[model samples]
Target: MKHISIIVPEGQSNLGTVACIVGAYEIFTRANDYWKEKGKKQLLTVELAGVSKNTDFHEGLLTVKPHTHISAIGKTHLILIPSLAHDYQTAVEGNQLLLDWMVKQYKEGAEIASMCSGAFMLASAGLLDGKKCSTHWSAADTFRTLFPKVNLQPDKLITDEKGIYTNGGGYSFLNLVLYLVEKYYDRQTAIFCSKIFQIEIDRQSQSAFIIFTGQKQHGDEMVQQAQAYIESNLHEKISVEELSSRFAVGRRNFDRRFIKATGNTPVEYLQRVKMEAAKKAFETTRKTINEVMYEVGYSDVKAFREVFRKITGMSPLEYRGKYNKEAA
Candidate 1:
């Protein structure tokens, strides 16, 4: 049987962390049970392992006790890092021993998976350097600032590279679990579990769920000005050259600073801002696609549709149909 170790990180647990750990454990163990019920041998040994014996959360209102300490688990076929606390830096810093253990396990041929902000711990351990990863869209800027080497794809629902896997934010970790089930077991098994849990399977992108609030914490006054200008002039056709000139910076220099500060080029940032506004309009008002497009300063319907789909993984009509209740 393949032994799967789900690392219960040593920190206060948030709802996302608790849900991911419990959900993964339940799904995988249930999969094993289903396999056994079919007259087949049990295929997995799932256990909660940790650096410490137990971790408490919600001011000690809740506690998680692991089946074994990491020291006792000599080897594991897979290791899953659950979502971490919101204070990501502290979460990663507090779990040093656990992170080191994960590194050792990976080196010994164990595939590792991280859920949501758990990617922070993996990146902190240097396991995700130069590898493609996905995490909560809200953490994209911070992740990039902390681990610039990791290819962070906040729009993707899941990312698989080498033997490591990562999934996007929140309850979307269920999709990653399904992906793993299919990869480790079979398509039929995965479909069975998905139906049992009532989770939508094969969800490939979390882009539609992302709320783009612009990364302005990098302290670039000029970039902040540029972002403010873009947000303020959403109805105007603003050019990067015009922005650079308004900020009195060279085009190349402006582009470099903007990317460094916001993790997006000038044009990309503008599109995201515009799309966010469009999304809001669709969610709250009875506006037609063309009305919202013109409101956001897109003159070319084809260009607007292409950018919207690229950023949101859905075309304008599709996005509206999904989000707007009153749209005809």
Candidate 2:
């Protein structure tokens, strides 16, 4: 059996971490039982290893015990890093032992997978540098600020690169585990697990579920004004030149500052702002797709639909049908 270590971050606090650990362990071990039922050998041996024998979370509301300490672990086939709750940096910094252990394990030929915000730890270990990784869409701005080298794809539900894997936020880690099952076991086994766990398999994008909120954490006054303008004028065409002039800034400098502050160019930010407004219209109104399209400033049907899908991973009608309670 391949040894699998789920390294619970030492003393890191998070509700999702507990769920990710329990959910992942249950799914993988149940897969092993399925294999034995079919007269095959067990596939994996899972261990909840940590830096110490015991760790507490959430002001000691929950305590986790490691099957093996980081100091005791030799080599393993796979390691999973669980997500954090509120504080990302503190959790990443607190678990220095696991961070070092991850680097050593990968160098010792172990594959790694991080669920949601656990990408912080993996990135901290220097594994995600020059690699495409996914995290919770809500955490994208903070993640980008910390690890500019890692290609952060928050729209993706899962990403696998060079033996490292990442998944988008929340319980979607189930889908990532199912993907791993298909790769490590077989398609049939993966299908069985998906059916057993009720996780959607092969889901490549989280766009349909994303609520497009502009990244505004940076303290750039001019960019904030530009963003507010774009948001307030979602029904009108926003010209970058007009914004720059109104804000008393040059066009070239405006573009550079906007990109640096918001992590999006002027055009992309404007498009996202419009799309978010259009999304609200789709979710709350009885308007037709074209009617909503016109409300969001797109005169051409093709242009509106293309931009809608580019931002939302679905056509206007599809998004409306899926989310608009009245339509449903």
lDDT of 2 by residue, 1-328 (tens): 6889997886556778988888888999888889889999888888898877777777888888878887777888999988886688888888898888889889989999999899998997788999999999988999999998999889999998889999999889999989988888899999999998888889999887777788888899889988888888778877889889999999999999998898889998888888988899888889988888788788899999998899888998888988888975
Name every residue pair that clashes in candidate 2: none
Clash count per candidate: 0, 0
lDDT of 2: 0.88
Q: Write the per-residue lDDT of candidate 1 for residues 166-246, one digit (tens) a residue.
A: 999999999999999998888989999999999999999999999999998888998998899899999999999999999
TM-score of each: 0.97, 0.94
Q: TM-score for candidate 1, please give it.
A: 0.97
